[model samples]
Structure formats: C-alpha cells, structure tokens
Target: MTTLYLLGSAAPPVLEISQVIEDAQGRGYDVCLGLTPSAARWLAPQLAELERLTGHPVRSEYKAPMTADVWPRADVALFAPATFNSINSWAMGFTSSFVVGYAAEAIGKRIPLVAMPCVNAAYAQHRALDRSIAELRGMGVTVLYGPGGFEPNQPGEYRAEGYPWGLALDVVGAMVSPTT
Candidate 1:
C-alpha cells in the first residue's frame, strides 16, 4: 500500500487541499493528512470531511493516537498550498507542528517531498523565499508554483475555475505505482 502524507499550512488555499486527498483516495491510495494549527483554524470542517471520506484520522500533533505510523514511512509527501512562512520554516529545519515535524522526519528518511507554494507575487518573488526554495530543491524536494502574473486571493477564498487537482492525483499515482 502506498501512503500519502498531506501536510497542511495556514494559507487559505489549504482549504482546498482536501480535494487533492479525496482524489487520491478515490484512486485507491492510502492517504493521511497532517494539519498545522493555523491550517486547522482555516479549514477544520473540510478536514473532518476528508477524514470521513478517506476513513483515516486527520492528525494535528504527533502525540495524537493514530492507528498506525503516519510519518517517515509515507511513499510521498505533498505540502500543497504551502505558506511562505512554512517554506522558510521547513528550509530552516523548524519542525514545531505535526505537518512540519512529519516533513522533517520524511526528509531524514529520503522520502519524496513535493511542495506547492501558494503566496502572493511579492512574497513569492522575495529573495528569502527564493533562497528557501533553492535550499529545499538542493535537498531533493519538488517545489511547484502556480503560473506567474496571476495573483491568488487570500487563503480559503481564492477559487480557480478548474483547479489542477488531477495533476496532484497524477503525482500520487506515480509515487504509488509499482515497479515491474
């Protein structure tokens, strides 16, 4: 079984991350979600729904009693709608929350890490953010950004006509696919 660790952030776009989890579950991948404190405030209801749909718990802290291990052993880890703060924190080795802690643990184990950053152009274009992204890349993390020029509104508020949830599912598919 392929394990997918969905890391959360406080950014508004994280509200839609459950859709990606739901899509992956539909494809028969075992998915577990970890939420940051801010992310829980923005989208706990949606996270609850995802848990119901996926039949798995949504973890916010490491101490929470989970059915099984949910970190380090995941086949793939995706931090979608990652906030600028989260990008820097992860790059700097700050693992305070379950989301950050799980990512850090996964990095130690050399698990595939994918991050889709959601931030305004100014923050996204900042030198510090660039350096963080580069640092994560150096560590073999896949960083995905939305198209340039188009600005997304505040988190949990922006809505694209047809968001690319399928692409994320494709990535999960590839991560879970068996080698012949």
Candidate 2:
C-alpha cells in the first residue's frame, strides 16, 4: 500500500481528522499523521487513539538528530486544513513546525504534495495568503484552493463538515495510482 503522510494544521476541520484517516485507509493508503504544534495540542486527548488508528506515532515536533524515522517513507503528502500561519510559514521556508517544515522540504525531495487551506474570509483577504499559494504552486505543490477547492468561510462561521477532505484524498489517490 502507498504510504500517505496526512499533515494538518490548527483549523476547525482538524477536529474531524479521525474520519479523514479512516477514509484514506478505505482508499488503500497506509496513513501516517503529522500536525502543527497547535493542532497537536488541540487533538491531545485523542493523540494516542490516533496513533493506534494509524499504527504510527502522531509527530508534531522534530525527533532527535540520530533517531531513525518512525514512519515509513511517504509516497505522497496531503496537507489539509492548512491554517494561514502554516501556509505562510511553509512558503517562507520557516521550519518551526514539523508539519510546515516537512512540507517545505518535500518540495525539494520531489514528494508528491497536495495542500488545502482552511481559512476564514477575513484571513483570506490577507495579501500574504495569495502569495504563499502562488509560491507553493510554483514549487510544484498542488494547492487545492479557489473555486474547485477549499472556499473560505465567513469569519466565525466555520463549517467543519463541509471541508473537502475527499477531494484532497481523491487527488492524492490519483497521484499514486498507475495512469494508463
């Protein structure tokens, strides 16, 4: 099975990540999860269960220098519910958070990458968001934004159930499948 690195940020939709992981598993992926520090804190109570579900540790911070990687090599990475900060940090090469840090390096490693942002309309209005999206796209990262992807919701009107996780998974599935 293809190893998928499902990375997430501190967004409302992250609360439903268990379903996303199960959905990916249903599509035949060996899922390993990573998260931003804030997201990890948000899901703290369920971290052990999530690790059990994925059969891999939920990594939020960087491991020790000489330690071996816990998760298998990722065939593809799907970063969803990417917060505004995470996106900008990744595009700017800030490696503070393990989620954004891995995503930034994944570009140079040529790992197939897909990203979907979960930002409110107010946050979307920031000029940096557009620039970051464009930068990620230029780096060969498939960003699912705009009309066909994640549409920003109004401030304080988070619609967690409406997050397009299936769309992101579909794209990742296509990436790892053999195309005739």
Candidate 3:
C-alpha cells in the first residue's frame, strides 16, 4: 500500500484540512495524519471526521514504546499548513511534537517529503523563517514556497481559497510516481 503521512500545524488553513486528506487519497495515497499539539487542539472537534476521511488515526502524541504502530510506515510525508513555529522548531531539531519528530527523522530515513508553509507576509519577513526554510531545503526536503507553491498573505488577510493544499498534494504525487 502507498501510505502518506499528512502532517499539519496550527495555521488558519488547518481548519480546512479535510481537503488535504482528500487530495492525498485522490492521488492514491493511504493517508495518515499527524498534528502538532496546538493543531490537535484546534482540530479536536473534527478528529473523528478526519479519522473517517483517512481511515486511520490522527496522531499527535508519541505512541507508547513497544506498542505496535497504528499507521502504516510512510512511503512519503507532506507537512502542510506548516506554521512558522513548527518550521523553525523542526529545523532546530525540536521533536517535541509528533509531526516535527517524524520530519526530523524522515530525512535520514530517506522518506520522500514535502513541506508547505502557511506563514503570512509579516511572519515570512522574519529572518529565522528564511533560515529554517533554507535549512530544510538543504536537507533535501521539497519545500513548496514562493510562486506556484505557498505565498505568504498579508497578516490578517487569510482567505481559505488562497492556501496551497493542492500544490502540496501534487508534489507528493510526483515524488511517489512509479513508487508502488
């Protein structure tokens, strides 16, 4: 089976995460979602709905050691609605959250990966975000940013139509081509 790890952050676009799952599945991926702690809280009300869509758990916390893994091992991973905080933290090797933790290790595991940032223009201006993006790209993660991917909106002007969930999914499909 072609399994995908769909990771989300607590960005505004996370409210419409079902689309991300839908896109992944449409591209023939068996979706498994992981949320940052804040994202898990934000998406709490829709946890069951998300589970229904992915047909798997929406994991936030680390599974207890020695427990059988609930989701299939990832053939590819996509991190969307990737917040400024999550990106910076992951780049700095902070694995406090399941998504970041997996991403940190996925690089070494050679898992095909994609990341789509949901930062606004104001936050995008931060030097640290640039550093983080650069670092992730340097590590061979396909970061979908700038034109044709994700573009920062003006702060406070987030429109759901503007998020690039589709772009992230498309990149995933390409990465997994002839993949299984």
Q: Which candidate has the highest lDDT of all?
A: 2
User: Which residue runs does candidate 3 get wrong by more than 4 Å?
Assistant: 178-180
From the highest lDDT down, the ranking of the candidates is 2, 3, 1
TM-score of each: 0.81, 0.96, 0.94
For candidate 3, lDDT tens digit of each residue in 47-160? 999999999989999999999999988889989889999999999998999999999999999999899999989999899999999999999999998988888889899576
Model 2, runs deviating above 4 Å: 178-180
| Per-candidate total of colliding backbone pairs | 2, 0, 0
Q: Candidate 1 residues 11-35, lDDT tens each? A: 6556677667767776766777888
Candidates 1 and 3 compared: the better one by lDDT is 3
Decreasing TM-score order of the candidates: 2, 3, 1
lDDT, each prediction: 0.72, 0.93, 0.89
User: Candidate 1 vs candidate 2: which has greater lDDT?
Assistant: 2
- Judge candidate 3 at residue 91 and give its lDDT: 94
Output the worst ten-in-a-row residue range by lDDT, candidate 1.
Answer: 147-156
Model 1 off-target regions past 4 Å?
64-72, 146-163, 178-180
